[model samples]
Target: MTEPLFKQIAALIEDSIVDGTLGIDQRAPSTNELATFHRINPATARKGIALLIKNGVLYKRRGIGMFVSAQASAIIQERRVAAFAATYVAPLIDESILLGFSRTDIHALLDQVAESRGLYE
Candidate 1:
């Protein structure tokens, strides 16, 4: 089970925005609605929403509701890519070292896979 409820919520919301499941200028679900929908606490929902707001993914409209920012998808994508690299790469490097693999060996294998997949840079 995922332990970080707020972070999981944040990722779901961010993915919805980035993938156009949620649209620009569209009002997001209310905190109470989100809480109910995800079976989480209202405060947890608020934390997720607050993170998006701080990251410029959403904005409040006084007493109306929270709306997705025009640049929400872009911001979410940037954040996701950054987080993916940090989350995966550091652990991968540590694991490779523990498995008796050198950095150069890993880089060569990564390049091979990238080239095979036509993702080489």
Candidate 2:
């Protein structure tokens, strides 16, 4: 399913935060700039920005512009981790159950995959 425009915009900003393209107290693109750059409606961009502000990922200066919150990256990371579990881990477990795989089997399989990818060290 396609994500909503506002959510996509929010995700974009979150990604920027995670990747260090945006840092704490750094100014964010203006709503108009986001709208123009993404070819989206200004209102949609504003709504996305508002979500960040509400979630404490961003704050506004009196007249300067929006800036990343001091803890924006941490906030974004927490949200993304929760979302990842919901979006991927839950479904993987459900599918494994439907396929008659035991929990041990799943763990072993994951371990094997991680070893192959050099991630089990």
Candidate with top lDDT is 2
Per-residue CA lDDT of model 1 for 19-111, tens digit only, reads 788899999988899999999999999998998899899999999999999989888888778988899988888899899998799989899
Task: Score each candidate by Cα lDDT.
Answer: 0.89, 0.94
Q: Which digits, one per residue and each the tens of the lDDT, describe model 2 over residues 8-93?
A: 99889988989999999999988999999999999999999999999999999979999999989888889889999999999999
Off by over 4 Å in 2: 112-121
Candidate 2 displacement at residue 42 in angstroms: 1.1
In candidate 2, which residue pairs get closer than 3 Å at backbone N, Cα or C atoms, i.e. clash? none
Worst 10 residues of 2 by lDDT: 71-80
| Cα TM-score per model | 0.72, 0.86
**Candidate 2's C-alpha lDDT?**
0.94
Native-to-model Cα distance after best TM-score fit, residue 27 in candidate 2, in Å: 0.2
Candidate 1 achieves a global lDDT of 0.89
Best by TM-score: 2
